[model samples]
Target: MKTFYKYAAFAAASLAGLCACSSDDDAAETGSGLQAVAQPQIIVSDLTTSGFTLRWEAVDDAGSYVYTFDGGSETPTTDCRLEFNSLERQKEYVVAVKACPRDPAEYTESPFTYIHVLTDDLEQLPQPKITLGSAYASKTVISWTEVPEAELYEFSVDGGEAATTRNRTVILSKLDKGRTYSFSVRAMTSDATRFTNSEAAQLSFVTSDADVPPLVIAPTTIISDAVAFDIYASSDETYYYEILPATTFAKYSPEELMTAFQTYIVEYAKKQGISLQLAMASMLKSGTQSLQMTGLTPELSYVIFAFGMDLRGNITSNLSSTQFKTTADGYSAGPNYGGSDWFTQRFYISNAYLAMTGYGWTNSVWTHWKGDDVTDVRYRTLTTKLFNQVFPDPYDRQAVAAFLKDPNYGLQFNPALLSATVNSADGYNGLTEGVSAGTSYTLLTLATSSSGAETVCVNSVTTKTSTEAAAWFAAAA
Candidate 1:
């Protein structure tokens, strides 16, 4: 009898497909210059209560394909397979697809290959086979094989009011321990109207005896650069822990977090202890066991909290927490080599001058003017202006941009911008602080060239104020 019904349904669908093709053929041939391409071989692979899959042979020279489910919005795709979703449940649809060229100017579409498909009826949903699992001290787990057309399950305990759920399995919690309870379950349609079974499946179970909660020990060590810690469980049961910055912990109190965590565990676990055990194993294995904490920004503070479960189904009532600070940054000193004339920029404050003024420069010249801003004009103003004047043709800004982007770039400055001169004790060209008869001052010049050659010169300058001239001379001295 079932075989006869299956063949009759196939014959009806075939007849409907022929009629749909006959009507659509006229529409396919009526276009102006758009020649009809090859018809695709369509196959209906999968079907559900609200959707179906359609596949066809790939057409030669075709760039993309278009498909329509029951004359709805046309969707384009490059693949041969397409899935139609959100369809009207338990209704028949005339789905079609066609191939076309990529360019609109050269586009020529094939006559659509179509099929007739009927979604599974909600009233005819298949019955679910219920299975009972182990029961805990205050909980019992029940599961059912899924019915393809059912969206929810109707469950009841000991003739009580029916409860609805979208899950295939449910764990009844907070039940009286050592007490026996009867349970029944059935598949329900999405609309909540029709059910797969008129009579619900029945089963009985007894809760286990009382159990103890697992204990979690405090962490051993929390490092600065790498935050890590050790956690010990009372039993092999599961546990969970969370680490957050002090700023985040400040917003969520430990009590509030514990409540939320237990709520989630009760909803998902068969036994709270089992869920905690699994969570602890995963957290310690992935988060704490390896990194303790990974990707933590340096020089920051953080706090961590953890909860666990024992051999039975109990959860740790109180959460344990620990807080620590990351290490601070340190700057080490290095050699100070003066700037080159080939480069159009200068040290706003020369390393030699900075060293002499106790500005953290590594050079021994830091003995003079150990802490003074007397040479600010010479370091920040005249030095840059004089250095820039040496490069009449501006330095390559593009090269400078690349150098700024990546320090490892082979940075080379124009050699023509450099010049140097040296003075000797016999007749020195450089002087500490020279004053002309008119009260003008002499400026000391320190320029290093690209070839590693350095020069010293004393150029004359007129200061805006006599005090400024005296300051410059005093710094040079």
Candidate 2:
């Protein structure tokens, strides 16, 4: 800079000598035909890591100014002030400005004025604390302690494609189940040179496992009366599930849910007349994502609740659930009362020869019914019916008594009715058939409960024309 100033002073003196000695009209001096405008004195201010502002005193008789910065092309402007932005930080820059007379024929251009500038040094950014949470079989959440003045955070998993978030957290998905993973995170600014990026933070974590997999429930499909969902787990384990009215589900916390579900398991076992151990073993499911809930009543909202259970029926995992509302009746599975889908109750009786013969709608509880206990049979009535045809009004206590006594009312009364007697020690499910296209049908079945209570379960559905069944419920996202 000293060397540049020395040369500039010499040049100024040489120009003065030439102007003083000139006698011709083209001298471009005061006494000649034209005179040059005064050179502008550049003023620099507001220097920073990225940029600065430059202003020069306006020259008298000058119509405009021209200037250049950092060895860039000169930009002509009517305003004497200029702002240089988005420059590299901690770098030296040079600015040059020259004044031009309003009338070029009478006044020539002035000598160039130059100034050197160096921007302020860049600041170092501090590292953020990384936190790993909500880890599932296929995904995990990454978050960080907010850094003061941090504009954004960059994240990468196992050296894969990078992701960014203005917020403090991000979710990393499509991970392998029961696996460990490595993650790297750093804080940054939108402008790359504003502040030095914080050093990357390294973290290692393992997602939840089978016995402890966090149940992330999602609704895969929803209709007027049923909702199908899936469960996400890390390994194979049993899970107990229950769906409650939205208000009822909202009343319980995760801990409270665990306690309530515990009571349900015991009562469920007693109702099945099986040891609690056997009931517990039968309910747990194993899969990566099989989220579904059905038999939901239309126009009703519900929250499906589920949690991990040890092989012994002890609640071993935190409560995982989601909320959804069913639409108005379209097509549905039986039991419009709530959304219980069990249209056929599995019969459970041991050691005694049992044979039942009856012509009634409530298949689960008709063996012994005193007159007027008709509604009690309803427990067996509503399930998970059918048509406009005249049928037995099971709820009509007087009507049901008369119908059950008439042998003439056999299968002829309701030819569509179905009953299955299975050893249950073995299972039966090949009741298949052919059907028509674009037609709707209602199904009714009488399932005898273990306690000799008869229940009628109903399912209504319309045949679909396209797509395979498996595609509707595929792998989890």
For all predicted structures, in order, the TM-scores are: 0.27, 0.32
Name the candidate that leads on lDDT: 2
Worst 10 residues of 1 by lDDT: 468-477
- Per-residue lDDT of candidate 2, residues 1-477 (tens digit): 232343345434544443333224324455555667887766565455556666677799999987777668878989988887777866767666778789887787776666666655644355665645456655565556555446788888888888888876566667776888888888774443445456678998887675334666655455665666656566775677778989888887888888877888789999989998887777666555554554457788898777888767787777776677876534433221111222332221111112353211111112111111111213222211233232444233334334433455412212122222132322233222343322234433333334544444333334332221111111111
Can you tell me which runs of candidate 1 are displaced by over 4 Å?
1-36, 72-75, 102-108, 122-477
Error of 1 at 359 (Å): 91
lDDT of 1: 0.47
Cα lDDT tens digits, model 1, 57-107, are 887767888778778887888888878777787777876777776554554
> How close to the true structure is residue 372 of candidate 1, measured as C-alpha lDDT?
14
Model 2 segments more than 4 A misplaced: 1-213, 267-273, 289-292, 333-440, 443-477
